[model samples]
Target: MSLEDLYREVILDHYRSPRNKGHLDSPDFRAEGVNPLCGDEITIDLAFDGDQVSQVAISGQGCSISQSSASMMSEAIKGKTKGEIEDLTKRFRDMMSLDGEADIGLDPDRPGAVLGDLESLQGVRKYPVRIKCASLGWNVLLEALDGEPLT
Candidate 1:
């Protein structure tokens, strides 16, 4: 099996059985995101301890890319500080961008360099239209973290 095949399998696994797919009893922050183009919608609920994210839950209806991305994001951001989440968000956006090389901004020397399975979605960058589909959950996550009103 090739690397692309592995990434596809990872995405399919996450889509079929998502992680952190639910809601919290009383979340500190919540935001919803929608992609009008593809009709993907997601809601993110987050609970924070001090400046770190204590817990996260997501409920959504969307394509495999959106749902799986949300699942991957929920797992990746758990126990991370707001700064780390923001940085990850930036890095993820960079990865999704079509301009220049796709550097996920993860340094191998760092603790979380692998980006877990989230890197599997890097292939989506080739499909410019699907980028928004994959980013739906992440955009909602950023909004929730920023205390921005849901759109």
Candidate 2:
């Protein structure tokens, strides 16, 4: 299959069968994010075992991009350490931003390897408004991890 096809499949699969798409009994951290223009809202809960995130979950209503991004975020960070999560967030943000001048230290190829088919969403930059939808989960995750509001 082609790269675009692979990326589309990754996104569609997440949208169709999201991971961590519900509430947890108790959470180590929680954050809520909303994009008023698109009416997408995400509530993220994280459970940490020491510095490692033991569990992660999300509950919300959103467009396909927002919901699927949340699912991918949950799957990506569940067993990672805070530092690793932060790094991944930065890489993902940089990848999505597509700011030619941005100095994201890591070679996009290595991390993009893990991003797998989801990398196709990099084209999301072409749709300015949809950017927020794609970033909903990322911002929420950062806020929850930092114990602060995202805005």
Candidate 3:
């Protein structure tokens, strides 16, 4: 299958069977995000240990991009330090900003440049409108770090 097709399958898989799709009873940080344009909403709950994310859970309702992005992001941030998560978040935003170029640092062969399954969503950049859908969860994650009240 083509790379794009593979990416589509990955996204679909995440959407159909999301990871960390639940709530944390007592989370250290929590934030919710909504994309009014598309009506996508997500809540992120994080538990941290001395500046490291020990666990992450996401609850939301939205399109495949938003849901799958939340699932993928939850998996990525778990067990990561605050600094690492911040860097990864920046990298992900940079990836979303790509305008059809292969500069998101994704290289299947190289492997090192790949952002795991998160890179699969790179195609979302092609649809400018969908960018917000993909970024909803990520933006909430940042807000949680900033101690903003989630609505």
Candidate 3 lDDT by residue in tens digits, 32-151 = 888887788999898887778988999989999999999999999988998899889888888888333346657778643568888888778777777888888989999998894232
In terms of lDDT, which candidate is stronger, 1 or 2?
1
> Which candidate order results from sorting by TM-score in descending order?
3, 1, 2
User: lDDT (CA) for every model shown?
Assistant: 0.83, 0.77, 0.84
Top TM-score: which candidate number? 3
lDDT per residue for candidate 1 within 12-73, as digits (tens), equals: 99999999989988899999888887778899999888888888999989888899999999
The TM-scores, one per candidate, come to 0.85, 0.82, 0.87
Order of models, best lDDT first:
3, 1, 2
Stretches off by above 4 angstroms in model 1 are 1-7, 98-101, 105-113, 148-151
> Model 2: how far is 101 from its true place, Å?
5.0
Per-candidate clashes, comma-separated: 0, 0, 0
- Poorest lDDT segment (10 consecutive residues) of candidate 1: 104-113
CA error at residue 144 for candidate 2, angstroms: 0.6
Which of 2 and 3 is ahead in TM-score?
A: 3
lDDT of 1: 0.83
Please give, for residues 1-151, the per-residue lDDT of candidate 2 as tens digits: 4446424767878888889888878888898999878779999988888878887888998777888888988888878998998888877788677345234443465745656544656767667677777888899888898894222
Off by over 4 Å in 3: 1-7, 98-102, 110-113, 148-151
